[model samples]
Structure formats: C-alpha cells, structure tokens
Target chain A: MNTHRPWKLSVAGWAALLLFAPATVLAHQEIGQITGFASGFLHPISGFDHVLAMVAVGLWGAVLGSPAIWVLPVAFPVTMAFGGLMGLLGVPLPGIEIGIAASAIVLGIMVLAQLRPPLWAAAILVAFFAIFHGYAHGKELPEGASALLYSFGFVVATGLLHLVGILLGEAHRWAVGRQAVRAAGGGVALAGLFFLWQAVAA
Target chain B: MRRAVGTTLVALAAIVVASPAHAHLVETGFGAFYDGIAHFAVSLADMLIVIALALFAGLRGTRAARHAMFALPAAWLVGGALGALWPTASIWPVSTTLSLALTGALVALDAKLSDASVTAFVIVAGALYGFVNGATMTPGGAGGLALLGAVCAIFFVNTILAAEVTVLPVGWPRIAVRVAGSWIAATGMLMLGWLARPTLA
Candidate 1:
C-alpha cells in the first residue's frame, strides 16, 4: 500500500483540516451569534447520530462506485434547498426528531446492504431523502442568518464527507480494505438500529 | 470492526461536545407573534406528505416511483413569491392541511404512474401546494422562510433513513421500514392530537 499517494494525502489532509478547524472559525455570525451557514453546518455535525449517518452516506456512495458516488451527495443539498423552501412556506413536517434519528438508521442499513443502484435511481432515492434532510436544516435556520450562504456551507461540507467515503471506497480495491469498509458499514447500521430502538421506545 | 468502533466513538464525542448548542430558542413572552408564525410555518400537510413519501419509497424500494415529490419545492417557490408579493396574515392551517393531504394521497398513488404521468402529477400537485402557500400570509413579519427551514430539516432526516433502507437486506429491511413508517404515523397522530386538544375555555 502506497501511503504516499498524493490523492490519498489530499483527502486525508482535508479531513484533518475539517476535524481540526476551530468551531469559532466555522461558526457563522450573520444572524445574531448563529449565521445560517454556521447553524446548518453545526446542525448536521453537532449531533452524534447525524454525524454518523451523513458520513455513512459518503461511505455507501463510495461502495456503490461512480455515479451513485456523486449523485447521492449532490441530491442531498439540491433537494434540501427545496425542503427549506417548504419550511419557509410554513409547510411543517410531522415527527421531525424521530425522522432525523431514522435517517441514521436507514442510511446506515443502505451501506450495509451494499445495493448498487443506477445513477438515476440513486439520484431519485437520495433526492427523496434530501427533502427530509433539507426540511430539518430549513427548520433550524437561525432567525438572523443568511439562508443562502448557510445552505451553501453545509452543502459543501456534506460533499466533502462524500468525497472522503469515495477515497476510502477506492481503497477497498484491496480485499482486506474492502472487508474493513464493509465492516464499518455494518457497524454504522447497528448504531442506527440502536438509535431507532431508542427513538421508538421513547 | 475496529474502524466502525472508532467512527462511532468519534461521532459520540462530537455530539457530547456540541450538546450545549442544541438549546431551543427562548419564548420571551412573545407568544402571540411566535405562535402565529409557528402555525403558519409548520405545515402539517407537507410534513404528512413527506413522511408518506419516505415510507412509500422505503417500502417499495423504488425512489423513482414518486414523481410528485417535485411538487414540494415547486409549492415552496410559489409560496415564497406570494409572500414577497402580498404579506398578510401569519396563519393558514386549513389550506395547508388540505394541500398536504391531497399531495400525500396523490404521491401514494404516484408509484403506479408512467414517467409522463408522474410529471403531470407533480405539476398539478406543485401548483396546489404553491397556491395554498401563496394565498395564506402570516400577520407578523415572519414569512415562508422559517417554515421552509423546518421542512428541509425533516426531509433531510428522512433521506438519511431512506438511504439506510437501501443498505439493509430484504428479509430484515421491512422491519426497519415498518418501524420508520410507524414513527412517522405516530408523529402525525401526535401533532393532530395536539391540534385537536380542547382549547382553554
């Protein structure tokens, strides 16, 4: 395994950058203390469950390879904008909290299933779920933040995570690595299952 | 397993650190204004439809089946434009509920439609949602933006769930999907219950 590959280093470096970036630097101050971008970025990354689920999206995309690899990540942000609009229009989504938690469980399972859907199918599937993801982000956009910028920031971050998964997926060309990634997917699915149970019981 | 464990641990750590930031906005005794905006912004109809679509998609294993899914954003666009054009009252629960219910029912049937049929369905559905959103205006300064954010959050969350469904094997996937549907149904029921609760005399 060539650890010195530039592409690999670039991805690793980027992940490290995001991980080490100061919360204050990422924080948006547009609306009061919370800019829409800051809030959106924080919203997904803040919750442990959300963090796992989102990263899993990238991982699964990587496993599926190619088009799905790209489409799913793109689908989330584009549809999310639409969902945000619905939120703006006063269209409420019932069971938001539970829905949010379910996202983790559902996407996690998808990774474990390793279903390789076509590009178009992947787009549609991801888009459908994007509405839920977008609605959640729209609902929480702080009062004073700039909605456009907020949405943009989160979308960018989301894409990066997807890219991370793609890199990792590519690494799975090796048998040992593939098993490792699959195992990772299964683990994520299990965590989602736990969250689903907790949500249901509560 | 080690990698999974590591990822999970990191995720948990992140959540613990960010927990304090999840505080709800304080009400500041501005109930009349906030409540009005809240009602207008939280469309029960859209939420219901979204939940239904998510459930249907998860169960059927066909995300492309529901072309009416496009209606949601189209409605939002029209609603936003209307709000900009004519600012009025902050609440429109009746119109909201009706539009969402119609959309949900239509989308439920969408799985049966051809591509062209699905497109037509989405157009009609979007218009209805748009019309309802556009006609209703919140009295306060609050516009459709807030509601849009709320709904986006919900959709995003559901998307994550739908993705998970794809990962699960057929045998056990149904159980998870059913659980999700039940969760959505329960949430809808709870909201309805809250709405129908007897108002203070």
Candidate 2:
C-alpha cells in the first residue's frame, strides 16, 4: 500500500485533469449566447454607448462636487432598476427611444453648463431619466444567463468609469488640468449633440 | 461663464448631430425563451455598470461623494419598483423639458453654493430621481431596463468627460458649458422639428 501511494497520487492527478477537461471543452461549444463570467464581463464593455455613459456619470458627479456629485450618480442607477422592472412587466411606454436620446442630450448639457442643482431637484431629475434607462436594460436580458453575475460585471465597470471621471474632475483643482477637463466635457458634449441629431433624424 | 456657455452649446450641437443615429436597440419577433435571456443579460449588465461607476468613484478617495454614488443604484431600485407597479405612458413634454432645464440651472448654481449645500441637495435630488424612475417603467417585456441603462451610461460618461476635459484654448471652459447648453436646446429643437416633419411634409 505504501509503495503504491506515489503512483496512486499520480493516477489521481490524471483522473482529476481528465475529469475537468471535457467541461472546458463544453464551455466553448456554446457561442453567441453569453453563458459565463467572460460574457458578463464583455457585454458592458462591448458597447461604446455603455462605456461612455457609465464614465459620464462619474465625471458629472465629480464636477458637481459634494452633494450633487453624490446625488446625481446615485439617482441614475437606482432609478434605472425601476425602469427595468417596468420593462419586464410588459408595460408599454411610448417614445421611450426618444426619451433615452433626450436624456443624453439634456444631461450632457447640464454637465457642460455645470448646473448646480439643489440635492432634491437633482435627484428628481435623474430619477426621471433612470426609469427610461432601466427600462432599456430590462428589455434586453438574454435567456438562461445568470442575472446576478451579469449585473455584477456591468456594475463594476460602471463604478470604474465613475472613478475615472472623479479622478479627471479632481485634476481640475490644478490650473491647467481644470481647463483641460472642461474642454474634454465640451468635446464630449459635441459628440452627444451629434448623437442627438442622429437620434432625432431617425 | 463663457466656458460654461460654450460647453452647453457644444453638447447641444452633438445631440443635434447624433440624434438620428441614437436609435434604441430593440429585439423583434424572438421567442419568449430567447428574449428572456437577452433581457436578463442586458439588465444585469446595465445595473452592474451603474453600481460599478459608483464604486469606482468611492474608491478614488472621493469617499465624501459616496452617498450620491450609492444613492444612484438605490434610486433605480426604488424607481424600478414604482415603474413595475404603476406603468403608464404620457407625453409629459413640459415635465421632461422642465427637468432638463432645471438640471442645467442647478449645475450652474453649484458654482455659487457652499459645498455643504451641494451635498444636501444631491441627496434629496437623488431620491426624487429614484421616485420618478420607479413610477415610469412598463410592465413586461418592453426592454425598458436595457434602454434606460444604455441611455444613462451614454449621457453619464459623455457629460463627465466633457466636464473634465478641455478641447479648446485656456479660456474656453465656461464658454464650452454654455455651448453645450445651446446644443442641447438645439437638439430639443431638432427633435421638435422631426416631430413636425410629418405635418410639414
């Protein structure tokens, strides 16, 4: 028995490897449908719209500074979930697409304007947009995917974007950096205006 | 002031330019099975992104700003619940435009208010936003969540970058803000024009 121990261990290792080999292969067979962690990670990052908006949330928060800085960021996601549930429930909302585009335009302008809203007012405005945004999300869930995992991945990415915005905004405390950051906002707003035009035309 | 105005004008211009291409993504004629899966992936991704943005901000030593960051997701949850419960579709042009206008005004106001006031304002505003979202969602299978997520992500990122970066000369930030505002107003005008196109045609 003692003599066989080393050989047995090797056999066990081989068996373990063999046991898991097929699972890896099987994982690859499924395509197009996001089934695992990787897909979850890729989904949010894959879309340009998603990346831009997530980062924008953080940037705006940082620029607003303090309460608005915090309020607006929180208002967006929380309200978005509510909108998602509505989409899931099969309710009909007219002009949702238009609303979504308008949100981009409006929010972009606010950031550029550096609008300093009262906390209550800011929350109210953001919540309104959140509904439409959430509904858009809920309406796009894929089948048989782990909702929790997917949510986890996207949320993490969104937070990172916000951090990026915050960092950029903080840099503005310096003279040159401040000008640079504001200009970036202007550039993005220009992009958004372009998008808005496209949305309206369509 | 000039920088702010300039930023607003630029943003508005972008919106007007981009509006036509900013169509919402919709899945058509798919079975419940497929659609359901799509919905799940999209919603999860959307919500996760929101949370992630907040978390990221929190981690970057903006600990003081965490409340509003956390409030965003919470507001969404509340708003989503409201939307699920009371689903309705109304034009609400005045309400919608007013909200945007108000936000713009507030951004400008922040320049004047004390930091403490800004904090308080954000919390209350965040909750109000949560309520509005909660009350606006459809009941089933409309892809509202995905749309909301996509839009939020888009605007949030764009605004953040725009506010933080300077594409023009040193004296352009304030001008840029006003430009963005004008651009937004222009997009609104364009939207109105598009709405009117059928009658004119």
Candidate 3:
C-alpha cells in the first residue's frame, strides 16, 4: 500500500508547518490551556472498545425497556464518573482494559440473547463495568483538560452514544428489526472478542 | 537523509510530549464585559449550577420558578458587590461542583420541592456563587463592570432556561429535562475528577 510519502516531500511539509508555527505562538498559547470540546467528545467515541460498550449500554436499556431506558443512560455516566474519580485518586482497579473489553462481550450477549435482569441487578452489573471505562479514561484524561466545557462535551457525547444504541434498539418494534438488533449484538460480540484477544495478548 | 529523519523525529516527539493546559487570565476579544460573559459561559460548574437551579425550580412549577428568577439574579448581584469590595476564599471548584451535583440530582429526580425551599436554595447558592465569580474577576478591578456583566448574563440565562422548562409538556419533553439534569450531574462529578487529577507540572 504505497502509503509512505517521499522523504523530500515529508521534509518540505515539516518545513511548511514549522514556518506557520511561529504564528500560533503569537495567538495566546502562553496564557493558559485552551479547552477543547471536540477532544473530550472524541475521547469516549474514539476507541472501539469504549464505543462498543457504551452503545451496548443503550441497546440493553432499550431491550430491557421501562425505567432502564432512561435509567441506564443516567447510570452509566454517573457510575463511570465514580470510576473516573477512582482513577484520579490513583486507586488501583486492576484489569481495566480486560474489564472494558469484557463489558462489551457481556453487554453484547445481553442484547443478543435478550437477557432481562431485575432493575437493581442490571444497574449493578452495568455500574461494575462502568468503573473500568471510567478508570481507563480518567487515567488518560490529561493535565490541562480540566474545565467544564470539556466535561460537558464528554458527558454529552456519552449520552449521545447511548442514544445511538436506543435508536438502533427501536428496531425491536418489528420481528425483522429484532433480528437485526440481535445481529448487531452478535457483531458487537465478535468485535469485542477481537478486542479481548488483544487485551489478553497485551 | 539523516538530517531530514532527525528533524521529523524531533517534531513528532515535540507533538507527542506537548502539554498545552494551564489556568491563566485570557482576553475574550471583546472587553471586560464580554470577558465576564465568556468566563461564565466557559465554566462547567457555574453553568451547571445555574441550570440545575433553574431546572429544579422549573420542575417544581411556576411559583418556584418565579421565585428563583427574582431571587437568583438579585442575590448574585448583591453577593457580587460584596465580593468585589472584599475578595474572600475561593470555594468554586469544590463548593460549586458539590452544588452542581446535588442540584443536578434534584432536577433529575424532578423532586417536588416546596416553593419556599426552592427560593431559599437559590438565594444562598446565588450569593455564594456570585461572590466567587466576583472575586475571580477582580483581578482586573475595572470598576466592577465585568462583574455586572456576569450578573446580567446570569439573570438572562436563569430566566430563559427556567421559563422554558416551566412550560414543557408532560411526557417525553419532561423526560428530556430529567435526562439533561442527569447529564449535568454526571458532568459535575467528572469535573471533580478533573479537579483532583494531578497536573503535569
């Protein structure tokens, strides 16, 4: 896949960027950290494991129906927040990557198999997995990323990911759509297996 | 060839290791007034606290909403005046975030708060929050204009949000309000995480 650019071209590109770099220096880079909405929003959605798990949350909630529909959306973020808090405190919760990957596998199966647990039980299960995600993200949250807009974007993005799952779960309205939703679960499970393999291997 | 590789490697290394975050005074391209507005706008806890207060009031019905509309801005103004006069300890990142979480949780529950209770909550919260805001803006000490701008902004935002929530229909719209509250609640907790995180420096 001839993806590599010629060295000369790369060097020239570097030179061009370097030339404009001084302009950025004059644009208030020294005052303080500039907060980003896109980056925060992207953090959760950017990784495959996180996306699959978060979406699975919505899918499971939709399939479970009732209070969970709204409750799961709320629970995951708040629970994940505690997980993030734990990570910030450097409180060790081992197997973070494995747990995240496992969450996808388990949640995907919940949708694929249409498992229905009690509300409290489901919340606890989901909350347990949420800690893994929160810890991984919290540890990686970076130094200057501390601001409200960033947090807002991050939280909103998580809610949106759940929304995607719920919308897809709406397919359960019909038999064919139910099959489609189950197929999505199977697909998520498959992807999760790949991630699990990588985590274990790592 | 080696020179080019080294240069590329250096640039890549620079990009990878760069940390571009700190808390410092920034210009908002408008003036102190706009600076105040932007400051409030950019703040997560402050914005969440106001939204939670408004949503809590709105969910409690019109009387509560009305009281908050009047009480919040006025209390904030008075507190801001005192803050500008004498700066006090900053309780923002912690106290404000605590308020954000609690008030947000209240909104999410759509709790049936008494009108008097709602009014009292808004007044004390507003004054405390406004004092912190005013103290922060006093770095410029430009005749309290920025603080006034922030206060005006607080008033407009509170009124508009509370008004809209007050009029929401009974079903999905109300559910959406609750969802929004939960999001705010989650954001507050996450903000606390950020606050507690160690900086690179």
Candidate 4:
C-alpha cells in the first residue's frame, strides 16, 4: 500500500486521528445542562452508550421479525416507564450502570449472532435493560419536573430510535441489505465492547 | 503542515469531548403549543385512529377519499371550537378506543362504503378527535396555538394517507396496506380485551 497516495493517505490519516483521540473525548461531548421536554428527548440521543444499546434493541427486534417487531418496541417503553417510576419513588436497584453497559454488549452480540430467541425472551431481554435506562433518567429528574411530560419526551425519543432500528433492519429483505444489517450489528457490538471497557475501567 | 495537523487534532478532540454519558429530562422552551403537538404525536390511540382513517380513505379511492380530507378538518375544527367554548365536564372516554376498533375493523374488511357513508364516517371521526383535542387545550393563546397545531397534524396525516392510497397500484403493496389494517384492528381488539378485563375480573 502506497502510504502517500492522496486518498489512501487521507484514509490512513483519518484512521490515525480516530485511533489517537482520547477515549473520554471520543466517547461523549458536553452540551451544557439542558432541562424540560428537550432535555428528556435529548437524553437518550446525547449519550453514545444509550444510543448504541437502544438502537441495538430495535435492530434485533427487526431481525427477529413480526410480533417481535412490534412487541419489543412496545415492551421497552412501558417497562422503562415502570423503571422510571421506581426511580421516582426512590426504589433502589444495584448495578444499574453495569446493567446498561451489559445491555449494549449483550444486545449487540445478539444482533451480531442473528439470535432468534422466542418473542417473550427477546421482550424480557430488552425490557430488563429499559429499566436501567429509565432509572438513570428518573434518578436525575429535574426538581419540579412534570412526570407526565418528561416521560412523554423520553418515550417518544426511545420510540424513534426503535423505529430507526426497524427501518434499517428492513434491509434484511434484500441480499445486499442482509450483509449491511449484519455489518451494522458488528459495529454495534464493537461499540458495546468499548462501553464495556470504559465501564470496567471506571 | 504542522498547523494542519494541529487543526485535525483539535477537531477530533472537539468531537470526542462533546459526548454526554446518559439522558436526563431537560427543559424545552416550546411551552403549551409544542406540548399539544407532542401530546397528539405520542398519543398512540390518537395516531392509530388517524392511521386507520387514512388507510380507509386510501382504500376508498379518489372521489370518496376527497370527502374525508375536506370533512375531517372542517368537523374537527368545529368540534374543537365547541369543546373549547363549552368545556365539557366529561368526554366519551372510550371514544378513542372505539374509534380505533371501528376504523380498524373497516380497514380489515377493506369494505367499500357508499360515498355518503364514507362522508359520514369522516365527519364523525373528525369531530370526535377534534373535540378531544379542544377539551385538552389550555385557555388563551397557548390553547389557540395548540388547536392550530392539532388541526395541522390531523390535516397533514389525513391528506398524506388519502393521497398515497389513491396512487398505490394494486398488488403486494396494496395487499400490504390491507395487512396493516389487519394489524391495526388486532391491536385495537387487544386493547379492548384489556379494557374489558376489569369487568371480567
């Protein structure tokens, strides 16, 4: 490989730039404190970890096909609401961060492996992670927050991500699309590994 | 060369450092108007009704479907005005669910209603949803804006559905539309079952 060819050299340079960037900085950027409906909506989207895990759930659901397509998405938000409520009520659950990280890793692998668990099992898997995600939000809920409105914001955001997953997973209906979906799974799995590393290191 | 390298490094740092750890509920300056739209958007029941209505209109074809586009907005606005002005003490609580079931069933059957019948269905559906929206609206400017947003959403959704269905050719795509109707109907029935469970218990 000619290191000096313009396109190749630029690609190498870009790869180097990514590799050299500090994990902390590469992981997330601070956008200052946001609150209210926008805050709730932005919450899931802002975090790389949350985005990876939630999208992974959708991708897996799509891959699993019918019933699961709708089932997982529905189960997640409802169960997540329950988790959020638990947080609001000051109920304690252990290893919430670990669980969240594990979600990304496990769900990513599930997509990567093309696992087709029974619909109930898949629902249970995503629903379990949704709690921690919800709890994280619930615990940090702003003072004087309207529970109803805040819940609405996050639920919509989560739903949109799932929709993305389902839409992308629809690619499976095509041969080329199948490979792309699997590649996306691999990418998510890699991100999950990164999150796991970050979690363990912390 | 050194300066270019520095610039690249700076950009990369900016990207990495800007990421946040997790989502939290934060303030949005949108206020009640956005809230109304948000409420409508997230209301699964409301959306389901709109989708079913749209699917029905699409199946009904051009002349019949146009009635829905016209009648629905007019009725919705009229009903909204009534609800806002009179401020009903209680609404038909099951109206939404029932609307879903009725429309879903219609879609599932892929029934071809007479133009008048289709017109009647559109008006009734429009009035019911609009009334709900109006009743939910807060007083004054925000309320007015909210009503506007609701009408826009409803009009937009109905227009899109009615238009798209007319254009969709017969075959698998059309069949898929009917299948969607079946799913919507199934969901409504499931909801009804849940609602009925309390009585059964």
DockQ top scorer: 3
Report the number of the highest-TM-score candidate. Answer: 3
Instruction: Select the stronger candidate by lDDT from 2 and 3.
Output: 3
TM-scores computed on chain B for all candidates: 0.45, 0.43, 0.77, 0.83
lDDT of 1 at B22: 21
Estimate the overall C-alpha local distance difference test score of candidate 2: 0.48
**What is the per-residue lDDT of model 1 for residues B10-99, given as tens digits with 9 covering 90 to 100?**
655654464333212433533434433444344434445555554554444445434334444555456555654655534444344443
- Please give, for residues B1-201, the per-residue lDDT of candidate 3 as tens digits: 776677777777665655543323444356777667767776655677888898899998888999999899888888877777776556566777877877888888888878999999899889888888777667555437777777778888999999999999998788888999888887878877777665522
Between candidates 2 and 4, the TM-score winner: 4
Candidate 4's docking class is incorrect
What are the DockQ scores of the candidates, in order? 0.02, 0.02, 0.28, 0.05
Clashes of each: 56, 181, 2, 15
Question: On residues A57-173, what C-alpha lDDT tens digit does candidate 1 reach at each position?
Answer: 778778887556655665555455566555555576876556666776667667767777677876676666656766665556554444334444555555556557667766667
**True-vs-predicted CA distance for residue A195, candidate 3, Å:** 2.3
lDDT of 2 at B187: 22
lDDT for each residue of candidate 2 in A1-202, tens digit (9 for 90 to 100): 4675565555555544444433223221234325544554565466554455555666677777775565555456545545655655546777665566566566666666777677687678767865775566556645455444544344344445556776777766787876776666666666656766776788
True contacts kept of each: 0.00, 0.02, 0.53, 0.00
Candidate 4: TM-score of chain A is 0.79
What tier of docking accuracy does candidate 3 attain?
acceptable
True contacts kept of 3: 0.53
Worst 10 residues of 2 chain B by lDDT: B182-191
- Candidate lDDT scores, in order, read 0.53, 0.48, 0.81, 0.71
RMSD to the hidden true structure, all candidates: 17.7, 21.0, 10.4, 13.6
